[model samples]
Target: MLLEIAIGDAYGAGFEFCGREKIMRSNTLESYVPHELGIQAGCYTDDTQMSIAVAEVLLANSDYSSDAFADAYVRCYKRDQRQGYAKGLQGLLDLCVNGADLRQRISPESRRNGAAMRSVPLGLIADKNVLAQAASEQAMVTHNTAEGILSSHVVALMSHALLYDKAKLVELPDFILEITGFILRGDWAAEVECDALQTLHAVNTALQANRCMSTLLLDCVNFGGDVDSVAAIAMGLASLTPEYVVDIPASLVNGLEAGKFGSSYLRKLDVALAGRYPVLSAHLVRQS
Candidate 1:
């Protein structure tokens, strides 16, 4: 799922903020597109980086507390902080040294998709109940709003349910709403913005409308604003589905940026997480 997020993030980086008409015209599926931010093709952004931070916290600490979440995110952000973070977040990342600093300075009302994007790995925890709590906590460290927190929970829980065969694709949106009580309605054809609800709706819409991972991701990017975030969420979830898993092309799997915390590192982390989670052992599709 983390690997899939990076693929979608890198794939959509180029067309982010480009209107639906333009994106539909280009329809740059099956490969990475060149980003205006000058990010190299197949290189992911802050979306995947912060997700790695959350995954790192989970891997290192059994507690998954707020402090560990904050520290891991700060450490990950500081390593190489140039992967398309929003300007306001860039400033916050600059000032925060640790969990204490993060607690003192982090905004409580910010409702962005950052939390949802990073909440992917929370689904790997064996205990679904514990996973739900960790999911909310992980989002609270960054985006601390009802929508922000619930959006993360939805993403994380959806991942868990799908991975464990607790839910099916057709019933996913209803199941999420039933559990989280966060109803988000939107047109996938419309512009998807930075708002947590809108982004989640767009991603959900795209996921339900398309079975092919490539088409689902295309639906996400075509929505325009915050394209990478929507695509990242959509593709991450789609990768878990048996039908969609094979639809992802090899170019994305092989073409992602390589180095520390890059393609190879994500694969290693996936293996390590699967070793502990066991549930993930049979579905290690990052190498597939």
Candidate 2:
């Protein structure tokens, strides 16, 4: 799942801020294209970096610790700050590095996709009942707004559900709407829709049209705002389906940036977690 998320993030990184019309004008969306960063075509952004950080903390602690996760985020940022991290997240990570209280440092009013981007790991590692709580706890490390937390929860829950029940994907949009509506009731319900909801709505539209998974991924990335995060969350759900798994190109997986905590580290975490959880091991075997 982390690999899929990273691949999606990398694929979309090049088109992050491009308009939908420009992306649609491209000849082929199957292969990666280099973004303005001057990095390689398949290099992932802070989305995968922060997600790997979360997975590392989860694998090391046997339980979620906000401080440890914050430390991991700081460490990853220090290792590579060129992964296009949002200014708000960079500020929070700086505070974490300086030993500040992370909870207090959170940007409660800013509703960026940082939380949703990295929250998939919690979904993979946690059970359904505890998934939302874990997502909120991790999200609150940087994004404390109701919108941010709820969006993260929606991604986490949807990822978990998709992993176990790929057949339920047809109902994903309604599932997202139902869950988001329940979370943001009354006054909050009338607020503007968050990026996570917009992503899911796009997914619902694509599913209804019977589009190919690759096209759906392209559409998600081309939605314009928070492209990498939205595509990561959407791709994480889409990747669980057998058809979509085949749609992921070999170049994307082979092209992930490599280092101490890069693609190799993600694989190690996946194997370790799968070993501890037989169900995940079986799922991995099926994927292989």
> Candidate 2, clashing residue pairs?
none
- The TM-score of candidate 1 is 0.92
Q: Write one digit per residue (lDDT tens) for candidate 1, span 199-235.
A: 8889888887888887777778777889898888888
Candidate 2 on 91-140: residue-level lDDT in tens?
66665653245555665565766677787767675466567767777777
Q: Which stretches of candidate 2 lie over 4 Å from their true place?
A: 20-22, 25-27, 37-39, 91-106, 165-167, 173-196, 203-212, 243-245, 286-288
Worst 10 residues of 2 by lDDT: 184-193
- 116: Cα error in model 2, Å: 1.2
